[model samples]
Target chain A: MAHAADRRCVVIKADVHLAREGFTMDVQFQAEGSVLGVFGPSGAGKTTLINLIAGLEKPHRGSMALDQQTLFDAAQQIDVRTHQRRIGVVFQEHRLFPHYSVTGNLLYGARRENGDLDRVVTLLELSPLLDRRINQLSGGERQRIALGRALLSRPQLLLLDEPLASLDLRLRRQIIPYLRRVRDELRVPIVYVSHDLTEILQLTDQLLVLERGKSVGCGRYGEIVHTDAVLSVVHDRGMNNVLVARVLEHKAEDGVSVLEIGPREQGEPTGRLFAPLCAAEVGATVSISIRPWDIALAAAPVSGVSILNQVRGTVLRCTGHERRMLVDVNIGAPLIVEISRRSATTLHIEPGTPIVCLIKSHSVQFVGALGPGSPQ
Target chain B: MTPEEWSALLLSLRVALWSMAIMLVPGIACAALLARKKFPGKVILDAAIHLPLVLPPVVVGYVLLLSLGRHGWLGGWLYNSLGVEVAFTWKAAAIASAVMGFPLLVRAVRLAMELVDPRLEQAARTLGASPWRVFATITLPLALPGVLTGMVLAFARSLGEFGATITFAGNIEGATRTLPTAIYTYTQVPGGDGPAMRLMVISIALSFAALIASELCSRWLTRRIGAAL
Candidate 1:
């Protein structure tokens, strides 16, 4: 709880308990990032947690504070109303007021005189949608309006509770960057709750893992998923290694792009990864998603091989189950490598052992620009 | 038409309009309460509202006459205190009609409000809107079609009200006699067949027109409201 007092970093500190229809949520965590990804399975209290933070639902007993402001404190007998708390929420259903047009919905929460309507309109590209009826907009367009409406309120925090859940894959991909832009431009602390870990991984680095109404773990993905139970959730779903890489070179002739992976906090560039096709401009930081199965471990960089991406890293941890081993390799940011028991034995892999990861350029599932001013 | 017929027709329109206009606010208020709230006596309140619907119209008129008529408790008090007489007058007829028509109005509006998604209101609250603002901006407009339907239903009821108005306000030729009472009076006398037939035809045409107008209006409102979602 004292860690929540970190004035420079932490924005949300919540310790709450609620029980609904036998599913209890007695979780607690302190979120300290612009976007804190909340990962959990079904009935994991993800919605309950954010609803408490937003003041939509009250906890039976607990305290939740945003910055120095106490949102709720049962002992203190303080319970702020939802509207007065000045928090914005985009529900999974995208509950835009059906009575109002796009502009009307956007400005519904702007109680202040100068509502900062222009910024949200421009950021979400809501100008054209202003006069349109809600039914007139496409799924992607409706979500943008919902996001824009939440932003216009100029709330202290934004809770996106599965905003992308109902969207199809293409629509989901379309809305992701707009979400990133909202975080970058508004700098509002966001608690993004999602059942799909893939969306959470794409949204933020820091995560709070909740399972069965308890805080299982809270840290970077590489640290939290190492827990046996959490790893199984990831293993069953076939989680991938996501690399934030800067587009360093684009050889259009060979139809390939060079992506430099894993930007350290304050050090030299970590390693190089590559993506097929001439996608994105040089110097643009892009997310490179690759499945562990797509990567092959090697003793050294194999020369004259058709494979394009190869990086050297140390093995951090190796755990085995059912003829398979999950080798955590620190190639700058930790990446999970799925290998069979045969390869684990043949490679003699252990913690602190240096190894090379082989990945074909085409195996890079995705590559796209993050934002305009993303650091090189 | 005779001067008495003209006055009676005009008076009936006035009574119906007054009845609808006076009941509109309270009808909607009660409907919203019944739709959204649960109190200790919610079932009783609900039954009280719909009692006029299930009971005979003459019975409702008797109740109104007993309570709010000239010599009854409330009416007697007003008569002695303020020299106001409502019995055997157009005002009594309007009150009787309003009481009889309330249930239809409330039922339509309540159903419409109930159909509205609660999540929409929750979303509005998170957007910094107070509950009152949410009702003004979200609830009212979304439930507009039902409200319009209720008002038209009330208006139609008042226009054709017979038993309650006759019992409470009496069958005065010009001052208190509405269209339904006038048609009844014409049929009860000699050499009244010609006027009676004309009034009967006029009554049917007016109701038909009213129904058509209500249909057109509610459909337009429903389309406009649903177009946004």
Candidate 2:
């Protein structure tokens, strides 16, 4: 019973110390999951953490271990060579060999003894792209091939460093499903490093938040975002409230998709949020992101309001900085509502006060097609 | 052309080809090391590789003679242990050419190696390739155009070699007498204008052909590697 946690997953214990270009990186964290997201802003040692894990770069002094394997132990002078580490990496630039065809690039690192080449090729939908030259593939296609190639390498752990950062919004959406499939079907343990909070949440709930070469926090997105200091850093990026919901009904005439926030039994009417017409099956779960500015607080239910989503909740707290005020309303999930000081004072919004929160269906962005694990 | 002239042309081609062949692997190895690696004697090694480019060709030839001649250190070892004689022979001419051309070969390949993004090599490393395999598959193929350019440059330099070849090989007729050495012989002798002029035209034609061939080959290689994104 004492070792029950050790058997379920691989434990990545990283205590890395590296210095480059006047920036010294001394960050440490333990990640245990199928997909651990490394969250950080630009130049915050996000990629550095990934590089050290993949053995692309060595730490000046530290020890790294994965699932009982000693990767780098500076004290013992034990550094596993990159090739021998069996850790696959998909760089942000998607570094596919230009001289090779799609299939050649995919098979570059594939293991002859035990590599699932055809399965990955099919999983990432790479059959039509096998014979094409790398130059001919689009940005999304290149990333798919890169993902397939890394998976074909038969790595014990896959490190993806902002695999969709270089892509546009459309391309990012296109690649998110492939990432979900990698996690769900293949069930390979992955370390996904990204600066985008929403994108990170799309793939996994567990995260290691980094700031300026230091790990500020590491936990579920719902838990780590509550810290006052962590909230301030994330606030600078206009962070939004996210809720895991499942699609219930898609009405084309209304141009809205009804999504339930919790498990919808036969008669248990759970909270339902509506978003614009989304390409989701009737029972599929999705992560919806609502910007704080789009949420409106009301003292009572009012008609003639064009907004579709109205949830009853209590005001947790209200705080203001500069010209914006953040009103935390507990609507099943913590939803931050941005409002002017005039309205906060006029409505007399305070902690423990019952309120009705209204948000337009159009404002609710369906950001991610999460697997069945979502929709609590 | 007379048989003597024909022989000079053929001997020059042979020496140049031999020189390029001798430096190919070592040239790329030196270039890869100089461009990608940081070692204790890096700057010193770089300066030594480029010594022939800066110092006089005759000085390089003298050094080669002292170190590689029959009675010289390495030359003595080679002759005594391996029964291979290299002083004042066509092999000596080729050695002289390789030495003078060494700087050019390394410079071109080094520049190409530098242009290759180290990230690509790192990507290959993370994809389960050994360091040597990464160099062979990613680094070598990407730098192919530059490698080809360096080889052609070294071959051209060897073909036109005069000071180093004459100083070390002694210009033996029908053996070490390459095109440039033969041209020098004609120019020095009285009433040698006919042979010298004929050889001059032939030398220009051959040099141009070599240049055109090198250009085409490098362009083809670049096309095969595809343009950098």
Each candidate's TM vs. the true structure? 0.91, 0.88
Tell me the chain A TM-score of model 1: 0.86
lDDT of all the models against the reference? 0.82, 0.84
**Pairs with backbone N, CA or C atoms under 3 Å apart (clashes), candidate 1:** none
Task: Name the candidate that leads on lDDT.
Answer: 2
Stretches of model 1 off by over 4 angstroms after superposition: A1-10, A73-77, A252-255, A296-299, A302-306, A315-328, A339-353, A372-376
DockQ of 1: 0.75
Top model number, TM-score: 1
lDDT of 2 by residue, B176-215 (tens): 9998989999999998899999988988888888889989
Candidate 1 has an fnat equal to 0.94
Candidate 1 CAPRI grade: medium
Q: Kindly list the per-residue Cα lDDT of model 1 for residues A329-353, writing each as its tens digit.
A: 8888778888999999999999999
- Best candidate, DockQ-wise? 1
